[model samples]
Target: FMNYVPDMQKNHFAKEPIMTPPSEVFVTQTIYADANGTFHFSLLKAGQWGFAALGIGEQKTYKGKALSQDAVIWVQATKLP
Candidate 1:
């Protein structure tokens, strides 16, 4: 998990433009998936969370070039009433 930043710098990767701020990350925890390629997180704090699964896709190549597809998601959790 990481904190959200309002301002960010410009950076590019794989023909894609990215903007990320330089700030201290709150947490960097690694979780592994089971044989079915499924994972879960529990007891999470109420806030914004970011999840990324890098290069975990089945397709290893595309158009004769090595390709690694990544997945990312962002979620906002609120406290229970």
Candidate 2:
């Protein structure tokens, strides 16, 4: 559990205002994708869910160092009435 940490100068889109960072963050779990590049998680609660795909892109290096083309997608779920 910690406050949101902004990306460093190494980020490719450090200047873009795509979205605002959360005030606080918590990592509930970390799961890796399978050989087929897929993962699954059971939504046990009804709220916003964030799926972060880290280092899953073809571009893997920058300035002779490793880089990550990370992505995030949020989903909202509702229980059946």
Choose the strongest candidate by TM-score.
Answer: 1
**Candidate 2: stretches off by over 4 Å:** 1-27
Q: How would you encode candidate 2's per-residue C-alpha lDDT over 1-81 as one tens digit per residue?
A: 112334766654345433444432334568688988688887655556778887788988999999989888778777767
Task: Report lDDT (Cα) of residue 30, candidate 1.
Answer: 82
lDDT of each residue in 1-81, candidate 1, tens digit only: 344443345442234313343443434668798888688987356666788888887889999999989888888888999
Clashes of each: 0, 0
lDDT of each: 0.67, 0.65
Per-prediction TM-score to the true structure, in the order listed: 0.56, 0.52
CA shift of 56, model 1, Å: 1.4
Error of 1 at 77 (Å): 0.9
- Model 2: worst 10 consecutive residues (lDDT sum): 17-26
